[model samples]
Target: MKVYEALAAAFVEEGTTDVFGMMGDANMFWMNALAQRGVRQYEVRHEGSGLGMADGWARAAGRPGVVTTTSGPGVSQLATSMLVASRARTPLVAFCGETAWGDQTAAQYLDQGRFAAAIECGFVHLSRGDLAEEVVQKAFYLARTESRPIMLSAPMDIQQHEYEDNGPYVPSTQLIDRPRLLPDPSRIERARDIVAASKHVVIIAGRGARGSDAGEQILRLQKRTGAMLATTLQAKNWLYGDTDYHVGISGLFGSRVAMELLQEADCVIAVGASLNSYTTEHGYLFPEAKYIQIDTAPNLVMGNGAVADCYIQADANTGLAELTASLERESVTIEGFHTQEVRRRLTAPLIDPSEFRSQPDLLDPREAIVVLDAELPPELDLVLGSGHQTDFGTMLFQRSREITSNYGMFGAIGQAPLITIGSIVASGRPAFVVEGDASFLMHLSEFETAVRYGIPILVVVMNDQALGAEYHKSRAKGLDVDLAVIPTPELGRVAQSLGGDGATVRTTDELRAALAEYVRQPRPTVIDVRITRDVLSVPYRRLWFGEDV
Candidate 1:
């Protein structure tokens, strides 16, 4: 067997079912080998799309996803998406094809190590054909354990060389998936004391809390302590149902009600959350609250954001379970948090579309979202791309278990198109992506990939003819916003030209008709819904002015 064949064997050994990539001559051999071994290949239009797909797959599958790209430009294109994945704590293995061994003068040859390091991603080069399998296994190990992206550089010349297998293939999980850490007794006792003293408490859960029974345990802790439940944007649907106590996502895109309730809490027990600046709103949201943070790996902090006064270093689920058990020793500290008044306040529409004046030519984005929120099927997985439109859609829509957004780590926008593709492939279910025009246009090629593969992804473009967030912010700041605006094109007709279904919607009735048709014959359909720039999100209004309307 050759080196590429051994790499394929390693992937199969580790049980990677789906491989996403933009194959070039350099990586084609290994890609073919993987395909030959019955691994489903999601051939993307661009290199970054492949990584984006892997990130989405990792998010959906709860395991490491794979992407293979050629060297130089292929690896360079992965930087932004890789950073997003890193911020998202996604486990991804990107096996990139490098220049031939000792071919430093090649045009496409790049210092892949430097590239990976610049983006803070793990990279390992397969220098020896005999140890190719070792590097592959190690890449998977780092990807899984570190919960970040790892790149395995396979030199084209070395990839064709005979693989000198020293022994049988051992799956990387056997070495990596050992027993994890549990919460310390002293720390649990300390956290309990903190909660015991507090009259008002709040639990802010993050991606770390999404694993195991952490969500269930956190809710239990909340019930015992009468604490409010809030989640970072990354962990929005960890506890899905809408309730007064269940404060929605807290961040730059946080609902007004969530931040208001969060401000009143005395002790905020952040479980499995990073307690980053975004979630905390730079400590403005809970500036005076006593923060008792719990995580598996609470390291030495450099910034004021992650700096917690009482740090409980343990697994989120385990720590939460232990801390809840300890807190259960005592009765509820306080009550009346989930009062009827609070429930009414929480349930009130964040942005009442009726209040906002309607537009004549274009549809109000809020109104369109409201209609979509009602019309969209419950089963279709929903994804939101980043922008002001996202702020509207994310807050407006009823979150299901099958929801994802670019509102994760880096807030990267363009990857949603590709991420939606991967998500559609993984679940074998129809999905929809509501994205801004600028964001959708960034990776427009991926839409073509969806069309080519017959992926049932409904692409909803909120065409405001500008970057909605920046446009609103620039105007508020009294800056010239000419550069923020773009020439709005007929994206719906473009989708049609590419052999996909499409409709250009301006009114609620038009949108309803398009949605009705889409539900009946779901395909790669583009609903280019033009939204007026006159309307803005409630968060935007609050951020710009001192008003929370």
Candidate 2:
């Protein structure tokens, strides 16, 4: 068997059924083997988008996701998004192909490892023989253990080189223990003290609070202390449907009541949330409230503006249990008169209208999302990739089910559609990707992959033909904004060529009809809504700078 063949099989053993990438000659052999092994390869339009898609998949799935790109420009293309995945600590292994060792004198040769290392990624070179299996094992280990990005560079010779075939190479099953929950008892007492003393207390859950058994503990603590609960967008659904005290989401696009409650609270306990600049309004999100921070990672405490009265480096669940026992010792009621009222405000339906007027040339993605949400079947799962549309979907697409996203520091655009495609296939549920036109174009070819896989996915492209968010910033920076504007083929035509339905809607009625028809078809489809270039829906810049919109 060839090294490429073994790598492909190893990836399959690692629970990867799909890989995202752009094909190039350097890695053509492995790509072919990956296809033959029944591991579907999603061909993206850009290398950056391929890495972005992998990062999104890992973040949503809570496992390592994979992507590949070939030598020279192909490998370089992945730099931006790979850095994003690395910083966000999304587990991803980008199998980048490098120029043949003999071609060291070639002009196309670039130091891919140097770049990846600078970004804090685990960079490995499979530039030698007899190290393929070890490299693969280390790659997976670094990816899962570090909870960070890892890049494996396979030179052309190594990729195609023949290796002695063993009967079956079963990978080692040993993995490091998952992050544990260890609570500090003294800190727990402090939390109990605050809960017992305050007439009104609020619990704000952040991304750090996710996936740990601690979520249930928080719920119990809420019930015990009569504390109202709110979650950051990243932590949405950490608490299941409609508990009496669950406040939906808080921040720039959050409900007025959510903002007001944070304002009114005397004691604010932040769990796992970094309470970064935007979430804190650069210090105004909770100006008057005393802070209590609980996280497993101590470094996060100092970074997210937590001048904690009590900081606990404990498992959120154990921490909560300790706090609960302490509260019981202090005779604090786990239930409250206002807890139900807080839940009522949180569960209240959002009635915010699209802020921008939709002109004939441009459409507001929020309005487009509203129309699509109304038209699509109510039961579908919605996962948005990061971009301008993520901001739009956070506000507009209100579904009862959980909305998952990769809000990691990577902030890569053009990866959402492919991620949705994989997620829909994996989850066996219809999925929707709310993406911007520029981001849509970034991985537009993946529509064909979605079509080939026979998965039903609805990709709503907020097609303004511009990098709406970045262009605005570029214009403000006095850069030539025109360079950011991309004139591309009509997205509908591209969709049609891929054997999928495509519709470009200029109005709400057309959008509704198109979405309804696409839903009925039960196939991959793209709904490109022409939004105005001047239309700004979420006031992203205003929110970023903590400006009153």
Candidate 3:
């Protein structure tokens, strides 16, 4: 068998059924070989979009996403997406082609390993054709174990060499060990003591709490301790139905009531959460709270420099279950943070009551989100793009299931559309991508890709005719806001030109009509909701102007 064929076989053995890529000379042979073996291939307009799609699939499907790129510039275009995946801890394996072996003068020659290191991605070079299977297996193993992107580079020249058949390839699943770490008895006792002694308790869940029975376990613990519930932004709507004591998302994107309640927490038990700066509001969210962190790798000090009084190193489900059982054994049930006033606060309107001056023909972004949230199907996957509009979408849109993933981890915009396409392909569910006008136009070409692939993704563009974040910032700084205020084409008509459905709506009624039509006939569509740029999002207003509603 040829080396490229062997690599394809190895990928099949690793259970890689879907891949995203754009054709390039260096990697085309192997990509073709993989496709011949029944792997579904998604061709993208740009290499960066392909990587973003892979990242999205990894998050939605709960597996290591696969992507491919050619040598030199094709691989170089992956910098932004690679860094995003690395920082977000998304599992991905990139199959990239290096320049021809020993051909330093080749046009596409680049030190691929060094580039991978610069982006903080794990790298494995396929120097020998005979080791192709082993190299592929190792890349998968590293990506799975580390929860980060891994690059597998093979030289173009070596891919054509003859390879002998080693025995059947062994998949990485056999070698991967996912043990559930249990909490120590002494540490469990300490955590219990902290919870029992505190007057007000709050339990914060993060992405680590998903994919297990952790949600139920967390609820049981909350009920036992009378603790209020909240989730990190990444884990938004996790405890959605617990309305009495649940205060929604915590941190910068949190609502006023949620942040206020979090500030008053006397004891905070963070489950499967990293307690990062954004989640903890830069270490000021829970000033008086005795912090207790529970996770597989519980550290004394978190990313925000907040010290935990107790750290329990265990799986979220296992640790929370044990804690609940321990409390039951002691017959300990404390009326900590559960009060009549707190219940009323939790049930209050989530959006700020402070009203902004309304524009004649433009809708409020927050109100637009609320309308979309109420109209869109509850089962749809939501992907949020980063910009000034992110705060509105994150805080206003509420859903029951916690299947949402944000493209704002790296604070980059214009990735939500590609990510949403991948998510639709993975989950086989309709999706909505909430993006700013500038962000949506970043990869408007991908709308054609979506049309070609027939992916059902509805992009809701919050059209404010500017780079919302920069525009707001420039105005606040008394700078030339015109630089950020670039006029955009009618996005709805643009989507139509790309072979997808489109609609431009300037009011809530028009927005509702567009959404209802899309729901009735699901397809690739874009609803450009014209929103006023004057009203600032709550988080942005607070952070930029020190004003709170």
lDDT ranking from best candidate downward = 3, 1, 2
Query: Which one wins by lDDT: 1 or 3?
Result: 3
Candidate 2 lDDT tens digits, 1-549? 788888777777777787888898778888898889898787877787777768767766778889998888888877777777777778888888888875778666878878788767798789765677767778888898788888888888777788776655555346566656677777787777776777667787877777664677787777776777777777664564546666556566555666777776777778887776656666676666677778877646433445688888876776667777787777788454255466567666655574557776566666767777677775777766666656667765654565666554567676667667656655667878787888777666667767776778888787777777777778667889898888767787689889888887788888888877877776788887887767454446554443444
Per-candidate local distance difference test: 0.82, 0.73, 0.87
Off by over 4 Å in 1: 242-244, 300-306
As for lDDT, the candidate ahead, 2 or 3, is 3
Q: Which of the two candidates, 1 or 2, achieves a greater TM-score against the reference?
A: 1
List pairs with backbone clashes in candidate 2: 84-410, 214-317, 224-334, 362-531, 362-532, 363-530, 363-531, 363-532
Kindly list the per-residue Cα lDDT of model 1 for residues 199-235, writing each as its tens digit. 7788888777776557677777777887888777767
Better of 2 and 3 by TM-score: 3
Against the true structure, candidate 2 reaches a TM-score of 0.86
Model 1: lDDT equals: 0.82
How do the residues 45-151 of candidate 3 rate in per-residue lDDT, one tens digit apiece?
A: 89989999999999889889999999999899999889888988989999999889888899988899999999889999999999999999999999999999999
Q: What is the lDDT of residue 273 in candidate 1?
A: 75
Best by lDDT: 3
TM-score of every model versus the real structure: 0.94, 0.86, 0.97
User: lDDT of model 3 at residue 3?
Assistant: 98
